[model samples]
Target: MDSETTIREPRAADGGLDLSPVSRGRTPLLLRFTLFAIFFFPATMVIEPLGASGTVPTLLCLVLLLAWLASWLWGLHDPIPVRHPGRLAISLLLLASIASYAALYAGWTGGSTEMTRASADRWLLLLAASAALVLVTAEVIRTMADALQLVRALLAGAFFCCLVGVAQFVFRVNPMEWIQAAMPGFTYNGGDTPFQIRGSLMRVAGSTFHSIELGVVAAMLIPLSIWRSLTDPRGRRWFHWAQTALLVFAVTTTVSRSGILGLVVALLVFVPFLPRLVRRGLLLSAPFVVAGVFLIVPGFVGTIASALGADTSDPSIATRVNNYPRVVQLLDSHPILGSGPGNYTPPDALRILDNQYLGSLVTLGIVGLLATLAYFLLPGIAGVLAARAAVHPALRGLAGAVAAGALVAAVCSMTFDSLSFPVFALLYPALVGLAGGVWRMVRREADLRDDENAATARGAMMARAPAPTAKEVG
Candidate 1:
């Protein structure tokens, strides 16, 4: 049969394709993806930075990576190549890192074999994660419609985790009963250094490795809620409102100053777009937002203040500052490639600099640092431009806020930590894919516009031409 005829036939009725499962209430692709995001993302914050002997989190990462790969191999979806110039730039940076590592291994007499081995392992893990990032980019592009679903899922999951933490704090109990029921004998692996604020309220860490990590998670969700509230329908307004309030409560309870700053940045960046949405949304949500502040802010503020003022005796912050000069001295000695990839611990490697750029420079050298910066900055720029060019008004608004929020997170987090954190690592590639999809849509629209203009111009010319006469026909 001809292709058209074959398509017209009821192939599923002919037993060519199974439709029963689809006809039943099986989850749609978007919803399945959303559920996956919801289940998996919150747990990322809880993954032990100090490696667990067991493989739950590692195994989960592997599974996610495989799922991303399977999506591509099964012909379910294909992602366009990212258009950022930084991709090439960063690859070159990795090459430079390899070169630096070679030099360090050859020349650095100070390096210990065991220490070198550990650094090498970390580097290998980083490369493996980078490969997974490529898969995530492909999967996201393949399933752009599912992107918002995944984002909403993340928001819901973060809120739920926060709620659990809050409940633990209020009741002064280990809320690990549900956890134990879910994964019998699953010990909470990480150390707990609880934040002590003047207020007697117990700060809850939930399942996250640290209360600070939990705070960051809450901060990240606020922008998404604000975006949805402003752009989603009135019936959905309450959902966003409730979500925002919950997230704010979570952030306040965690009491990370960095988290507070991140939230403020998200809000300020989003407020300009609020007026563009239905006025009722902004007005309706405003009172709830204010009320949440009264309910949430004091505890968070006090906790943050205590952490900052706690002690000159504990020189973690001071040591980080003091150690920078020696790091800079090493950088000056080996400026081009630096000591090597994972070869930065000199005789006096005092503190792991709480700065991504500095840490990158020490290992990857100038080249790796440049590459890392490109990887981050390129996505943010693409996101902003794509949001500006989006055809759908709601998506444009949302993309803009997401872009802003990610940008703020990048800048703020760099002061306190590196991208080695699970959430940050996942978000970097995910945002890249989002920007890539929006850019693809933008280009498609431009192409369509050009074609439309050409057609219109041709029609105008035809209309202006005289009708053919009998002489012309002869």
Candidate 2:
């Protein structure tokens, strides 16, 4: 072909690159693959059908680590930016772990020989996952529009879990039995109490390993349902009502007082700015709560009466009250570093503390406990700030809801169980992402204001300045 006839290469100035197709096509595939790895690995490893632990969870984690490593490698061409807000805090946490390990190795009394390298791996994995998510997601999806997709994904994921949880309650089955069959070594601890006013109802755990895990799932969904009701188009308003119903149904079945309290706390956090949404959301949710009462109210009353009246002579409540002093006594012995990570004895383990913050101090010491609090509270503060300053109605609602959910769960989790489960682990990091996104939105608005001011200043200076004259110049 003649040189003149040859197709000319695109130039740098003319809308240089067309990455629309590439970006759009690649994103869904990558995200789907990542989610698959995340959900599959943890599910299978712990149970079986989900994987051994869960193929999806395992790969999702590994991929995130690999992505971070790749960013380091690419730094030779262009250095990556810092995105992790809790980097300093997380670093201190890791250092504490190492220092504790060394103290135990040298002469510390509370250290355990059973504390293997695997314990270190567990903490490191969480830090790695948190750090990686902040980095990869900041690049892959930077805009508010992009972040909303993540919010939607979170809502959809929670909804699926809630649906399954409700099904478990109605059907009295694990539902994900194929995966459970593969992991025969694991035990199912679910049980329904009878001889009460309420019918026997299965506590819905869904894909999670415990009923409390289901509660965490419920708490996260409540905010999204409220957000949808407020910001969604009028035509789509009914969808939010349906979601509210689902959340109430699932939450009631879990029969967790902590979870119920969490729902109330989450709503309270957002109600000041979103009273209309709050009112509507609650109205939609009330029926499901009532339905739950109808199904289990009699049984619940009997159970409560048995405990309050001491009719059954069960020591569960009394035993927990009795153990509080013992736990306090034990805390005095290892206030700084605790008994060491993974250092719980059978007695300590069997105590059933029902308190995450106390349990953390007992197991991992003050350092871990503080880190846990910081992790939960930081996003909440950031989220509240976002809600206060949000410009778009939809984004504001979503951020506010997520923030509220985190706050509720933080309070509820502290009283029920330590944040050791995968559900809590997963939700915290996701909330961190949402908070970071909100911060970016706020920052961008500030930048825009600054730009507008600068432009006005420039125009005013030009208008006021005298025009140069030839005679004056000469």
Candidate 3:
């Protein structure tokens, strides 16, 4: 490759020409740990026995915060990329969360109580940790290669989960229970049942606390895996395609209507950005793919059909529909700053509102709601914009995948408390941070190209000058 092309290429730490600002300098240990943890998050769940209050994700966040603090104290923390619009939005959201929590604690919101106060405090801590994560991720993932590495990790994690889910479905094994049994203190909130059976087919939840959560994760991965399969070189293309199949199977096996819808939404967001041939091929193959799956597992098809049809008789759907009015009433009572995060009491037997948007409104109020929306939407918009401007094909595809994942999470939030879940909560924001980093990299490359072009033009003009040097010298 030419020097200009080499400058645009993504470089690794192993002797390649490092063009990324983040990669140019020695990466801090804490930042490296955070990056590694994020990619291997699924495996990290196995260490839940060490988590506070039996919540592994919470423990991980705490560790992240401590690492960040230690890094700061040691003067190893990189500057937060505040110039990135997505990062700026996240910082604003964190500030708003703190303010809202303070207002709730002081009874300024009119709905505050001891329960709300405690809940708000916990949420505030989580927000702080999440802000730190965003900052660290943006600082660390400064190139297309870095972003792609994270995506590959996510695919690997998703593939493993899918394999576990498949085993759970086929063999009726409860891996969570098995793990808890092996380690006495290891506990999970998922039920004792091996799988969730719906319409004569077994639903697989994998290692996540719930089936819906697994579905959401699978939905987010599908688009990204598809993009990778198409764009990756021949050596790795088949592997990514296989991963895509596994992810699709996992999503279907979850028997989650919202999950399917989320996948559809993500594909809709992703397809427009794809090459014409790939787009056409996907559109044409989708039906055959569905038909083939149905041929293999007819019972699974029934479950999907029933779920998609919005069967009012289905207990889950009925519960969600029934809970909508109560959620609205709760939101009405606390329209400003909310009662507190995770503090809204359900009016009925159902404990979960099942809708993240409504739950946020009731718990965090209008200000928090707006902030949450900005946190999610701003990064998604930034990803879409970055995809348009990205010079590298892989970077552009990765940006599109990020945007799709954000949209999928948003769609899933309509049916589940997606933002509260560990995988969704952490992964979504991290992807946004990655998107912001990619955007900055694209902008820098564009600026450099412009400067190079301008310099070349100036040199040409000087060469074309009519004997100006000889005349001036004389």
User: What lDDT is reached at residue 319 by model 2?
Assistant: 51
TM-score of candidate 1 to 2 decimals: 0.74
lDDT of each: 0.56, 0.57, 0.68
Clashing pairs in 3: none
Best by lDDT: 3
Full candidate order by TM-score, most accurate first:
3, 2, 1
- As for TM-score, the candidate ahead, 1 or 2, is 2
Query: How many clashing residue pairs appear in each of the predictions shown?
Result: 0, 31, 0
**Residue 104 alpha-carbon offset, candidate 1, angstroms:** 5.7
Worst 10 residues of 3 by lDDT: 16-25
Write down the lDDT that model 2 would get: 0.57
Q: After best superposition, candidate 1 residue 300: deviation in angstroms?
A: 4.8
Q: lDDT tens digits, residues 1-474, model 2?
A: 321122323322243221121122122345434543333323534433332223345447557758667767877323234443434334555666655555554546445464433453455556566555544544444443355445555556666666666666656655566554665555433321211122344455666656666666677668767666555432356776777667766666666556667777877776655656556766787676766666653465444333335522445445556657877787788777766554554465347766767766675578867876776677677778877886555556766886787687678766566345665566556566556655665555556656767978999999999999999999
lDDT of 1 by residue, 254-342 (tens): 66666677777766655554445444676687787766665655554455676657564545556667757966876776666666666
- For every model shown, what is its TM-score relative to the native structure? 0.74, 0.76, 0.84
lDDT of 1 at 464: 100
